[model samples]
Target chain A: MSQWLTLFQKELLEMWRNFKWIWVPITFILLGVQEPLSSHFMPQIINSLGGLPDGAVIKIPPPSAQEVLIKGLSQYTSIGVLIIVLTTMGLLSGERKSGVAAMILVKPVSYESYVTSKWVGAMLLMWGSFLIGYLATWYYTGILFKWVPISDFFASYFYYGLWLTLALTVTISLSAMFLTSGMAGFLSLAIVILMNVVTSSLSNWMEWSPAQITTYANKLLLTGKIPDSLFPSSLLALVCTIIFLLVGIFVFKRKELASS
Target chain B: MITINWGLLAPIIIIQLILLVVALIDLVKIEKTNGPKWLWAIIIIVVNIIGPVLYFVIGRRNH
Candidate 1:
């Protein structure tokens, strides 16, 4: 237990030393803040462009506060997915690429402990950042609209964020297991986008496909209408996440680190 | 304050069991390498469903 804690602390400290917080939090906050701010102000901005000489007849309807909040949340959701994928892609792969794994292997830590600690630390940090961003957006959106229910709004955002985090973690684990550092990071992004595209394409045929999980969760949160189909999709995602992480760890433990 | 879905949980458990079986097969086949097969096996088994990822990231040989 002490060893696990020590490893966790070491990994987290290393992450902090690398200044990941700066880029990650900045990007998250920017997305969070932009979502509400833009949604609140877009109508005015559109009206300002109404002075077109050619008379484009741009009748910009004022978005309701709920519409604004939802728009902001959707924007945040997309950006959040990107940030999680990029940050996690190199969690393990980077250590191997920099020869840090060799040094760590020489320590008293077992391979399992070391890898588990890193995974836990990364998940905590990633999930923590996401929660922070969600809260920030929720608070600001509530302040802007003054009519949005904070509890319901936050509940919906939280579930959506949770699902996104789980999906990205699986992608990261797969990337780390299969590719080198540069390739791992790129492949993580590719895999995520590909999953989205493939699942969406199959959504017509597969009634309970993973592609609709995020959308369904968001709808449930927003409207308080949980579809029976989402239960299966979410279950599938959870199962896939566990499988991917296990496969990654299994492959990593026996990999030829001498060449890595 | 989220509602738990047992029906959703069922499929996840099934998927995990399937993954575990697949991982065990891989571990058995790869036991003859330079490293301690038992240690690798334990790592894969103990890490539960995530063990395979660690194996892939740091365990397997290129050849």
Candidate 2:
């Protein structure tokens, strides 16, 4: 356990030096703030465009606070996820490439702990930054629009957080398998996008899909009701996350580091 | 042009400026990057939020 903690602390220090600690949260906050501010000033922005006819009346109904919050989430679903994948692309691949993995494994550290420590470190940065950004978005939504109930805020946060966990897990596993960080990052992104697209297209049969986590989160935010499949979907996501972690460990053990 | 609320929008601007500043500092301090350092400096300064993020993500080559 102490060994794992040491490895985890090392992972964090590396992230801090890489500026992941700074850019990730700040980018998320920027995306969060952009959503509400743009929505709040939508009418003014449209008028400023200067393309409308003289005395043209564009009647865009003011979006509800829930809707604005949902929009903020979409920003996360796209740009936020992109940033995350890019930032953590080098998680395992970089270590292996730069010969750091060989040096670490030469010590008394367990392979399982090493992989788990990386996952945990990435998860900490991801979840911490996301929570801070989401709260900022929620606060802006309340001030500019209506206040979202705290219960719904938390409920949606939990579900979305699960989805992000799944994304990070996929990246970690891929990072372990691929030698190149760019390949791992892009392949994981492709899988994530494909999962979302497939689930949406086959929504009738894909009720228990891990990709449904985002849809369920959106539902919770828009309507204060839980989907019946929420538990199953969350369970499946958790299972997948664990499975990916094990796969990462297995691969990391088998593959000889370039340094070795 | 509805009267712009600088007070309400100040935080976003401040956060963006911080991103710009951080990216610039890193660029100056780092020994090597994936591409030309000058190009990164231009992207960081000119490209808004995305520029700095791009510089951080793909610009700096980890040695």
Candidate 3:
């Protein structure tokens, strides 16, 4: 127990040293604030482009607060996801590559605790930054647009957070499986992208897919209603996260850490 | 020519500045980066939000 606490603290100290704590949340806040700001200024921005004929009446209807919030969140699916995957991609692979994993494992630390501490530390960083960023976006959306229902906002926040959790877990597990951080990052991203592709192309049958959480989150934002499959889908995602954690621990336990 | 509510936009600008400053400080202080330090400093400054993030992600070699 104490060992896990010490290891977790080390993970956090490492993150602090690398400036992960500083840049990551700043990036999230930046990302969060952009959507509402852009949506709020769309008409003027269009007019300033100056390509239209004289006296052109651009008739873009003002987006609803819900739509603005949803659009803001859409940025997360792309740039936000990429940032998360990039941030987490090196969790295990980098340690192993630098021979730090061997140094740590040589001690009395349990493999499960070591891997779990890393996962927990990464989770803290991701969730903390995400919450700060999401709140920044929410605050901006409220200021520039109508206030969304607090119930709906919280619901969508957890659902989107779960999606991020799943992405981070997959990246960590894959990092455990690979020696090269690049390969781990690439494959984890490919897997996430493939899941979105498959889920979209087969939405009819993918009701229980974790990727559908975003769709469900959008639904909550738009209609403020929970779908029937939300629980099952969330459960499945949770299970997948656990399975990935187990796989990561299993792989880490067996894999050779010293690369040189 | 587009007018922005600076009060509303100031936070985002400040957030970006924080990221830039932190990345620059790290670049200057770190012993060895994955690539040239000057190149990273340029990237951290010139590329807006993504440059600093890229520097953090791939620039500083993990010791």
Candidate 4:
């Protein structure tokens, strides 16, 4: 128990001392502020453009408060996903690159504890950034539209955050198993894009493909209807999470850290 | 995005399984080399689901 705490503390301190905390929160906050702000102002900006000299008249329809909120949340998802991927790309790979892993292994810490602590620390940072971004977006959207359901706003963000965090955690675990930090980050991004593309391409044939979990969660938050498709994807994501985490630990335990 | 299409899911699973099998074969062939076989195996098996990008980037033999 003491070792675990010490590991956690060391990991946390390394993360903070590295200034990751500052950059992550800054990035999330920027995403949060941009989402609702853009949704609220885009229409007005377009309208203010007036008619073109070529006789092109763009009729900009006013978006409802709900529409704006949903748009903002979706934008948040895009930016948040990118930030999570980049931030966690080297969570473990970086240590290996910097020769930190060899030194750490020489200490009293077990491989399980070391890897698990890194995982937990990464999760904490990811979740904390996500929550801050979600809350900021939710609050700003409510303020701008004056029609958001305040009671359900937090709940919706929580659900979305869980799915996003799980997806990111799996990505990080896979990244840790790879050799290069750049490869880890690139692979993580590719996996996300591939999931979306394959799922959409097969949407007509395969009603559910783990990718639907995000869409379903978004729908539930935006429309309040939980689709049956979400349940299966949710289960799949959970299973994948467990599998990836275990594999990561197994690989790390047997890894020759001195080589890196 | 939450829709059901078993047909789509089937191909995904099959593709991933095939990749996993190919990666395992590659792992066996390269196990005795000086390179890091486990790292290559993981990259090929796990990251190859997104294609062979990671494998090409970090898994292939350095020679």
Candidate 5:
């Protein structure tokens, strides 16, 4: 317990030093702010700068505030997810490569403490950045788009956050097991992208899978509609997160910590 | 430029500048990088959001 706190504090200090504590949330806020403004003004953007021969009528109805927020969320899933994954991909592997992990592990730390500390630190950055981004988007939605009910916004935010948590779990596991940072990132990203694509294609069997929780969040935010699968979705994701995290601990416990 | 709304645009610019400044500071402070350091400095300034992101993820190996 105490060991975990020590390592977690070290991880936090590492995050502060690396400037992730600043840039990542700023990036998220940037993306969050950018999404709604662009979506809201797209028609104006086209009129002012969209090159057309003298007269070309293109009808674009202003999207509903809900739709605008949803658009922002879709942005989060794509570029935002990619950014989140890539920035933190090196958490464990980089430590190993730089010999930081070996030094820490040498000091009577449990493998569980090492991995859990990484997980906690990554969560702090990921959740902190994401919530700030989402709140900014929500505030902007209220101003520039429409005032969505706070309940719907919070509900969808929790659901979407869990989905990202699942992604983070996979990333933590991959970073612990893999030696090379790039490979860990590539494989984790491939898994996330694949989950969305494959789960969509295999729609029936995977509908209740955590892969669809993101879609659920979007829908709930856009229309305040709750899918019946919400509980099953949460349950499956929680189970998977715990299982994968435990597996990562198990793997790291046995494997010689990163050699390079 | 007359049509531009500076009020609306200011927040975006501020956030981006924050990212840019932090990235530049880190690039200068770090002792070494995965690639040439000068290229990273240029990329951080020119490329907008993606520039600093890539530099942090790839340029300096995390300590």
Candidate 6:
């Protein structure tokens, strides 16, 4: 137990040293604020920059507050995931390459403690940042637009978080499996994007797919109701997260952590 | 002087400045990076939200 605590502390300190503790949340806060602020000011912005001829009153229909919040989640799916992938893609591979992993492993550290501590630490960073961003977006949306029902917001938030954690787990596991940070990043990025693309394009065939959580999230916010329950998707994503952690532990045990 | 809606826009500017400053500070303090320090400084300064993020993600030499 104490060993795990020690490893967790090291991970936390490493996060601080890398500036992830500060920048990750800041990034989320910025992303959260950007959506509502831009949506609220879109008309003024276009009028000033649209460069239209005089007297042309282009009456663009204003999007509902629900739409604005949903748009924010979609932004998170893209930019948020990219930032996360880039930030964590090197978590394992980089440590191994830098000889840090070997140094720790040589000193009576078990693979379970090492891998689990990392997963827990990474989870703290992701969830902490996500909550801050989501709350900011929610508050801004309420102030500028309208507040969606709290029940719906919480529901969607849970599902979206599941999807996010699943993606992050995949990233860490891939980094553990791969030899280089670039490969881990590229593979995870491709998978994240590809998952979204496939799920959107073939949603009819995959009613229970995990990507359904993202769609369900948007709808839950927009209509204050979930068109379909997200139980299956949420469960699947949770199971996948657990599997990824296990795989990471196995890989760390079997593979040689480069110490060059 | 043109009137500006500082109320709505000031937050964005403030947030951006904070990110820039923090990124710059980390850059200065870190011993080594993936590339030249000057390049990263320019990137963090020149680019908007993404610049500092890019540096943190790709620039730092974790080893």
lDDT of 5 at B39: 93
| Clash pairs (backbone) in predicted model 3 | none
Model 6, A115-136: lDDT tens digits are 8898889888988898888888
- Badly placed stretches (over 4 Å) of model 6 are B1-3
- Please provide, for model 6 over B1-63, each residue's C-alpha lDDT reduced to its tens digit, 9 standing for 90 to 100: 234678766876887899899999999998999899999999999999889998988888657
Per-model TM-score versus the true fold: 0.72, 0.97, 0.97, 0.73, 0.95, 0.94
DockQ of each: 0.02, 0.77, 0.81, 0.02, 0.60, 0.57
- lDDT ranking of the models: 2, 3, 6, 5, 4, 1
Query: Against the true structure, what is every candidate's RMSD?
Result: 16.8, 1.2, 1.1, 15.0, 1.6, 1.8
lDDT minimum window of 10 residues, candidate 4 chain A? A17-26
Q: What's the lDDT of the predicted structure labeled candidate 4? A: 0.66
Alpha carbon lDDT of each predicted model: 0.65, 0.90, 0.90, 0.66, 0.84, 0.84
The TM-score, computed over Cα atoms with residue i paired to residue i, of candidate 6 is 0.94
**Candidate 6 positional error at A169, Å:** 0.4
For model 2, what fraction of the real interface contacts is kept? 0.71
Which tens-of-lDDT digit does each residue in B1-63 have in candidate 5? 226677778887888888999899889889999889999999999998889988987787745
Give the per-residue lDDT of model 5 (tens digit) for A1-260.
Answer: 88789888988998899888998888788877777788777877877785877677888888888887777777778877887778767888878888888888888888888899889898888888988998899888788878999999889778888888888888889888888878988998999999899989998998788989988787777667788888799889999999989988888787787584
* Model 3 lDDT per residue over A136-202, tens place: 8888899999898777878888899899899999999999999888999999999999999999999
Model 6 score (lDDT)? 0.84
Interface RMSD of each: 17.0, 1.1, 1.6, 17.1, 2.7, 2.8
Q: What residue pairs clash in candidate 2, if any at all?
A: none
- lDDT digits (tens) for residues A33-105 of candidate 4: 5655666666565556653566666666666666665666665557667767766777777777677877988
Better of 3 and 4 by TM-score: 3
